[model samples]
Every structure is written in structure tokens, then in C-alpha cells.
Target chain A: GAWLGTAAAPHERPGARRGAEMKKLYGTDAAKIQAMEAALQLSFDRNCDRKQPKYWPVIPLRL
Target chain B: TSISASSKPGADPASLQTEQRARSMMRERFLRCLISMANKKIQFHMYEKVKVDATFGASDIDVLNFQVSDLQTPIGVQTEALIRCQDVISYSFDM
Candidate 1:
């Protein structure tokens, strides 16, 4: 039987697989931090009774 | 790590104070995160494609180790375990 292959098997490379895995596993640090902030919004401090109590706000950096 | 910025030589006092404020804020957020994770089932993603689940108990101030319960490892389930923070790349749990 005759078969055909793509021009370049990019996915076959180890580096490509690792790159794809990393992309799937973790997001950009900034985005991850944003998601963490969102999650924290829903969580209450163990010492607190309210849903979102008085928590210190993270100061924004100038640069 | 806790704080990355160190006041540079000849840096203005005002900027140094600002940097300290930022550091405290970040540390506070991280502490709050730890508190929220207490008693929650967390899934840890480690290096070499390893993943494990455990009930988070507590972590030291330095965050070098984590005290967990019912740690599900490849060998067997441990009643109580101390996981090295370095071994974990990331961990998460729903609120």
C-alpha cells in the first residue's frame, strides 16, 4: 500500500511536544495571578466568618 | 520567594516605602491563600508529569514544606505527609 506524509512532522519532535504540554498545563503568570485573585474573591479567610471580609488589597506596581 | 525587591543604593525614601507596601500586600495575599486552602482537597502538579491529591493542613511561613493529610501517592495512601514545596510546580483547589 502507498501512503503520504506531511511536509514536516513538527509534532513528532520532543521539543514540540514539551512546548504544547507546557502551554496546556500552565498559562501566563499574569493570567494565572488574575485567576487566583478571582478565586480568592470567593474564598474567605479561615479566621473570618463572612464570605469576603476585610482583606488587604494588593498594591498595584508602578512599573 | 517572599520579596524580590531590595532598596537600591541612593533610592528615594518615598520609593522605598512604596516598595515595602507592595511587598506586604503580596505577602498578605499569599497568607490569605494559605488560610483559604486549609482543610481543602488540593491537587498538586509536580515535575516529570506527576500529580497527587491531598488535604492541605498547613504550611510554614517560608512555604518550604506543606503539611497534608491523606496524601495519595504512587506507592500508597499516607495518613499524614509533609510535602516538599520544591517538588511541586503548582497546586490548586476550588473555593
Candidate 2:
């Protein structure tokens, strides 16, 4: 009921939508997959924040 | 649904569950492998036969980019860098 025509619908939230998609894709093990992805993403974000790593080459190699 | 191309359009529910479980197991194992690679020396093979080594850090959830440290390039060693996954043809590291 709260979601009806609401601006902050569940689908509007990327994280919530991702979790829902994972559930549809992974079924009973969605939580486990989601946890792994979250941890991996967290480490990437933390490293980028702390290291301030720049992209090498400064240009796309493939395109 | 975003089911794989191989999945039949009107597949039964039980078979769909089986397929999803299989996919989850495969993805979980792949993620575990990526986790184990952290801090290890990884050699990335790129186009034009260019190769470089870096201490593995972490990859984005989408696997589009890899954040690494001490990247050994042709010119000099970069203290830290992010490699676009699209540029990489393959990568390997010791267990």
C-alpha cells in the first residue's frame, strides 16, 4: 500500500532492486550471493577511497 | 525474466529453480576465487601482446574495473591504478 504511486518505490532504489533481481535469479541462495557481492563491492569502494587510484593509460585501449 | 538464453520461454517452475540454483553456485564459486586473488600478484594480458603485473586489490561487483596496487607498466611502476576489464584479454596468478 505504501508503495502505490509513491516516489520512493522499491524499484526506484537501486540497491533494493538489485536484491530483488538477485532473488529472482538465485532463488533460495540469493542472500548468500548478495552478501558476497556486497563484500566485494565494499572492498573496491574502500580501496578506491583510500588509494585514489587513477585509471591507467588515460584512454580506452579497445575503443 | 532475465533467465539465460538457453532456458525455454515456458519452462516449468521446478526446472527454473534448478537452473537458478546452478547459476548461483557457479557465481558464488567465481566470487570466492576473486576473493582469494586479493593481495596476490596478478599478470594481466592485454591486447597487442602487452602484459603487466599488479598486486590484486578488488574488482567492482559488475567486474567492469579492477582496482590494483603497485602496477608494473612499461614506463614505470604506478603506486596504484584501476584497470578497465574490457582492455584485458585474460589474467592469471599463482594459487
Candidate 3:
């Protein structure tokens, strides 16, 4: 079998190992993340979008 | 006119003012979230088990739609696209 070529194990790649660990951590936090979303999305309903009105009211601007 | 808490009837004026302040803060946080998402690779989960990856641009003020670039769809890669928020079940991205 061609299994003993490298000096180190497969997990020796730091970048790939860190990425895999992050994905696992994120999976466990899914429920907490959903709760956080509920808290943050309270004011973002459909009718909340707004922009400044273009009227005749004048406001001072500092230089 | 903005959607303030004052629209509700039978509510005390002081409490309505407090609620409007909280709502403004929550909205500001959400806007910050949107700003952080700019120019990132996002995975959008649509209906019917469809998932696509794209670079997120800006979303409309109402959040009704999101503008993306280099969207990798099933058919082909679109140079630019607008994804309706109603069609998206969820989206995720790595910081």
C-alpha cells in the first residue's frame, strides 16, 4: 500500500485543519445564532424602510 | 414618515418613546450587519434545496432585494443579479 510516504500525518496542514474545526464549531452554534437573529431582526420589517424627506425645511450644515 | 412606536393606540407616550429608541438602535445594528456583508462570498439558501454562492453587494433599503455579482447558479454563472429576499430561506458567510 502507498500509505507511508509523508513524514507527517494528514492533519499536519494547519490551514485545512483550522477550517474544518471552524465548520464544526459553527454547526453547534446554529441554535444560538437563530436566537440572535430574532433579536436583531425586530425592527427590520417590511414597512420600516425610509429615506429623508425632500421638503422645504432648511437645516444648517457646519463647515 | 418613519415607522415609529407612536402609531399604536392606548399606549403611554413615554413608553412609546422608549420603544422607538430601542427600535432605532436595533435598526442601526442591522445596518451594520449589512455593511459587514459587503464584498464577501455568501451562500444563499433558496427554496427547493437550492444553494448558490455569490459576492454580496448592497441590499435595498427595504431589504426586499439583494444585489450580487458573479452568482454561480445552476444553469450558469451570472455576471450580476438581484435576489428577492422572499425567495431566500437563509444565507451565511464566513468573516
Say which candidate scores most in TM-score.
Answer: 2
Cα deviation of B75, candidate 1, in Å? 2.7
Residues B20-59 of candidate 3: C-alpha lDDT, one tens digit per residue: 3554456457767886887899998876677889887667
**Worst 10 contiguous positions by lDDT, candidate 3 chain B:** B4-13
Give the per-residue Cα lDDT of candidate 3 at B87.
74
- lDDT head-to-head 2 vs 3, winner: 2
List candidate 3 stretches off by more than 4 Å.
A1-63, B1-10
The candidate that wins on lDDT is 2
Tens-place lDDT digits, model 1, residues B1-95: 69665544224556545544554457458867886888999998876677889887766544555767778877777766667767778999999
Best by DockQ: 2
TM-score, every prediction: 0.55, 0.84, 0.54
Scored by lDDT, model 1 comes in at 0.54
Better of 1 and 2 by TM-score: 2
lDDT of 3 at B46: 77
